[model samples]
Target: MADEVVSRSYCCFVCRNYVAEHDDIVSKSFQAHTGRAYLFSHAVNIVTGPKEDRHLLTGLHTVADVSCSDCGETLGWKYLKAYEPSQKYKEGKVVLEKYKIVKDFC
Candidate 1:
């Protein structure tokens, strides 16, 4: 059987960059957070591929790891993808799956 692809949006818990391309984390086996994990990104968008599909967009865009940079908190990710939803995206809270972190930066 194949994995099911989910659709959702992501907003940086801390930053002006609201929408991003990739938000959902691929492969649940991939480790992302040890303690309380947060979500953050540089851009936002809607994708139809799997969470492993990281290269949905192009250009110098692709925030591999997202950190607080201030307090050094391992946030979520910040990658490049399609534009986020406009006023229409306004809805209830959307839960997104976390991604796997191959490395980290402090």
Candidate 2:
């Protein structure tokens, strides 16, 4: 027999805030709800502070609050660092193409 495995799509916990994922959270408040994990379409290093400059491209392992642009779905998170040299920091949103999903995440 051939090897068989199934990997489902997952969204960021932040983006999924106001969508169907939100309802899942509400329903399974106490229990671990792993039903609606979304497949992120992009990968942005989750950095804080300014939106410019070149820093270490260290990605986050956990989904630390990422909200989707469309329908407000929480996609996967990118581990990012704060844009130092300034406190008024802007968050980084990882951009991913539709096809890149397989190459990047998968």
Clashing pairs in 1: 19-43, 19-44, 20-43, 20-44, 20-45, 21-81, 25-98, 25-99
lDDT of 2 at 13: 43
Distance (Å) between predicted and true CA of 20, model 1?
3.8
Which 10 consecutive positions of candidate 2 have the poorest summed lDDT? 23-32
- What lDDT does model 2 reach? 0.30
Candidate 1 lDDT by residue in tens digits, 1-106: 8987764544434442234334433323322334332233222332222222243222222234444333333444443332344412212212222432222211
| Tens-digit per-residue lDDT, 1-106, candidate 2 | 9986543332334332222211112111111133322222233322222233333332222224444554444333332334444421223323222221221112
What lDDT score belongs to each candidate, Candidate 1 first? 0.33, 0.30
Where in model 1 is the C-alpha error above 4 Å? 1-7, 19-25, 33-106
- Highest lDDT scorer: 1
